[model samples]
Target chain A: MKRFLLISLIWPGYLLAQDNARQIEMTQLLLIKNHQVLSGNKQPDGLAEHSETVLRKAERYRYQGDFDKAVPLYQQAAQLNPKRQGYIGYVHLAFLHDYSRAMQYLNAYDALTPTFDDIEGNNPVSYYRGVIYLKTNEFALAIEQLNKSIGDIERKHGSEWVNYRYYVSRARAFLATSQPQKALDDLDKAVANYKKSALAYYHRGLALVQLGRTAEAKSAFQDAQFFFGAKRVEALQAGQAVIPEDQLFPLYESEIEAAIDQLKLKP
Target chain B: MKKQGWRNGKKYALPGLFLFGFWLTTTAQPLTRDQLTGQWIGVHAELNNASLCPLSTYLDLRSDGSFYLGMVDGKAPPKVMTWAMKAGQLRLDVLTYALDLISLTNDVLRIGQDSPMLFRRFQEIAVDSTAAFQTLNGRVWETDSLRLSLFANGKLLWENCQTYEQTVHCWQLARYGTAVFLVTRGNAHTCEGDYKPLWQLTQSGKQQFRAIGWNGQAVATETFRLVRPLKLSEMPPANEFQRCANCFDGSRYSVAEPFLRRYQPMLYDIRKAFEQYYKPVVASGQSGLVQIQFAVDCDGRMGRFLVKGFDNDYQAKSFDPQLVAQLLTICRQKLPAGWRRDPLTDQQQSDIDVLLNVRLSNGTITDVFL
Candidate 1:
């Protein structure tokens, strides 16, 4: 028994040493071995895996744009866990860009928490609904939805605690309705919340342009340009696949430049 | 008092502190050259808190200090670069990663912070590609979900029998010792990520052939039944097959510029055009999103259009032909003439890939996702 125990303990160390030596020797050979190969056994039954597993699997397919395989799995995930509905709704809103369907899922998710605003992914249900309404060009409905989210938060914790993007989104809605004064108020709040936001400055320029404040519009556009360049540099330093701030707001440097040029022409 | 203080503080404390520091440094030691020099298969990249997308890429590190990186099933030649460990930092090509950013355990290597890329140690199984070619060349095969046609001229066509999505690719039977892999390489805008899954040839017969490959989630053996022999009259349509002139890194160009800012006005016009051209089919229970993905070549010509449909439940389904055709026309031919040239030609930019998703309520277009 002692001999067996000794061998068991020594065997692992011996094996590890051998592995290291073999790796070193293989390195010397320098033979080009193709590392690309499908390495896995047959897929396990979906019923055996957890809901999280199913959802992850669905995400893999969706990421590749294989909706034929992704959809049924997403359905399976929702059936497995009701809380996943909110995430699925977010996917519809953000990734799939299906606003109506997103609203349906968001509504379904919100029904679970009837008394209070339900959180989906990172944002609340009202926030997603507002974005959906904005996307669908229902400016009035978007403002109403945005109010539900922004008002409740501002009431409790004051405007400082609310996300600056929420204010920007509401400002966008106000701008669409020619409510330039209200838009400016929201823009001021957005700027105060996050001073370096290129998105806020760009929209602020737009509001100023609408109010015919040509000089202020030009200055806001210039600020927007500077911040946009700074943001791009930050994005580049963050390396590949880092989404830029301008991309999140779906704004463009060209738009700011165009706004500036138009304002210059006005003067 | 001085002697007592030295005994209590300096003597034991100095030695003890040195030993503790030594242990800490040794425990967090950088990975040795031997541990890193090997073949690796990409597992997946962790994106945004536990969400993983399969990474179909491979890394091969040689003792000669040179490492190769490429898509697993790609025809694009592998990129070769020298690598070394310097000052406790691991260098892969030009990108220097801190020692803490990389970890290897039980044949798995992970690199990076936040979205760490995972790779599994690859064990090569020798198989003759010449033998594999004899079985697969110049033949049409069919499975339940897909139909594959391998032409003798190094071209293959993959058709999703269910979705009716047809794609053409360059094919090669690659040998790694005793294992044979059927590699299919796609164009710049191919949805399946530069290339499809690497299929390892397992069994072969006159009428049926089987290969182990990824089937959406996990590896499964797909049996292909011989449909027919490839005819010489069938020509590979180079013109029809859209490819980017200079799309070296598959995701780099597309992901960096998901949408060209200069095309913003044109994009708006396209949306307006779609809504105007759209003739509502007015079918009951046919509400969904139709997503169209296409590529604009470096020369500013758009081609290689792929369409996908999802119902109100976000389930995959087909939409009315009228709705799909009208949208395709606007995207393909109805773009404003100015979109044909890259706006920022002075900077020498590459091709741009665009994905347009439109939500349909019955037959009417409701929303355009840019």
Candidate 2:
């Protein structure tokens, strides 16, 4: 009877201990999920240090093209420092192409930061916004934002500060809206300003073809091929400017040749 | 007293049964390190929600106890970390994510608490690294629905037999340690336009290879039998420009330029007429470029006039074909009256292709050029 009583008394205490342990484990799991270390040295500074370490690791992963790993780390960093939202937005937009997620991060960034005009200088937000709009097929919005970015750069730096990317992007927007003549003009400006850009020449060829200037289109395609070939060789040697191979160019020499052939057949 | 003790034991029987069931559910059979080695692919079951698209996840457990967790699709790079199993739980040191092991047998690994995810091992074939690229070059690899051809000049032709659509893409070979990646661009059909899929090339058998998708899952099983070897000399040059014989040569169209220059004295009249016709239709505070095409025939008559506005159709409904015709009519009316036919070269006998660009800023003509 005494043994049974003792067992009964200890069993309740054991159950209580088990419950407490389970609670502690659950808390620890939650903390880890939130990117917090469950050490005695836990402090605000420690959290910051942890965030920094995670950010560094994430950047390393990004540099090594391990974006799957980098994205989670970036999310952790953004949670730690809300200011990292913009950078995370750019990564999601440019690398992942997750437009909705990118827009969420960008919206978070916009909520945290001041407006573009109020910032008193040139910022890349407008440019990034323009690119996002372009990718989303909001052509008018893309042009408006891109124009603002170009105007800001021109106002702050000079006309020389207006890079070819802005013109090329705007040209794409023009093309999307079936304004081939305007696209051709912007492409011409892009080629004039940055002669080394194979993208500009490729776009120029598309615009020329749209405008029924097949001969000029052929010339532009040749220029695009020359520059792209040279760049590919240079990238192989120098290991710089190496874009993802699949994203190198949608159109190839055979496609360009086929386009030229089609034009030839068109009376 | 014994009967009383039996009654007490019977009173606690339900709780004991519950505790035993909980233990059985939580505590899984322990897995050995050796059993975990090699590549394992699984679906990310956590994203089971309707809005979330589950991707294939891969776990490459090396014999050395190091692990790489990533997608098989080559969309992103793998995460390198150390892994350990303890007390029927798997722990990843970097991620700090731990899951209770449910069961592991026959190359299938299941882990989780409530909803367990399953992973399967891939049957790997040893590949000869040196001859892999050489063997793959200039060969057509086909399956039931897909045909792929890789050229030496970095061009890849992919044809989808089901869709009957062919896409020309660029390819590059990159190596990191023993892993060889065949990176292909422009294949993804997504809202973000083109996406590059970095495929890990592994030779499965003699003249056969497997392309692992970004989700760390096997996407394609391809077999290659070399029909013809590609010679660099035989490959078509990328820069071969094809010119149509009857196409307009801009340099030979000199008469159109001189004609525009001679009409410069009437620039003010032309600008005024253009502004009067287009000012109301052009949006206020918006600037645009307008290209007007007209033929100055051998008889010197201004005819075949067409106007093209730079503004996108969606932005301004007023800038339509009718507006273009009206603008063209205004230009023709504003042109100088008489023109003398220039001496025709054999190459330049047609109606001259005269393209004039008129720049308008906020409903006023800013500049005009050829």
Name the runs in model 1 displaced over 4 angstroms: A1-49, A111-114, A237-249, A257-267, B1-287, B294-304, B309-323, B333-355, B361-364
> Tens digit of lDDT per residue, candidate 2, span A7-28?
3233222211222123223222
**CA displacement after TM-score superposition, residue A261 of candidate 2 (Å):** 4.9
lDDT of candidate 2 over B1-370, digit per residue (tens): 9999999999999999999999988876466666777887543222111111122346787877688766444445566777776655556544333433345766666554322345566555444556777766766666555666777876666556676545555565545346555555432121111223345566534466665433323334344343344554544433222111111222122211122332332344455456666544454744455667665543344554555555311122234444456557676776544433321111222234455655455555555544
Poorly placed runs, candidate 2 (over 4 Å): A1-48, A54-74, A117-123, A239-241, A244-265, B1-370
Per residue, candidate 1 scores C-alpha lDDT tens digits across B1-370 of 9899987887688899999999997785569888999888665554332444344567888889998876555434567888887798777765666677788876778776534566777766555567668878999988787788988877778787887656666678866546677776544243222344567677777798887664545445789899999974674464553443211223211221223434443455666677677777788766877888877654566776889888777677888787788889888877655544433231333455566778777677777765
Candidate 2 chain B lowest-lDDT run of ten: B46-55
Question: Highest DockQ, which number?
Answer: 1
For each candidate, what TM-score against the reference?
Answer: 0.52, 0.34
Quote the positional error of residue A54 for candidate 2 in Å.
4.1
Tell me the lDDT of model 1 at B251.
29
TM-score of chain B of 1: 0.55
Worst window of 10 by summed lDDT in candidate 1 chain B: B246-255
- The CA lDDT at A141 in model 2 is 91
Which 10 residues in a row give candidate 2 chain A its minimum summed lDDT?
A12-21
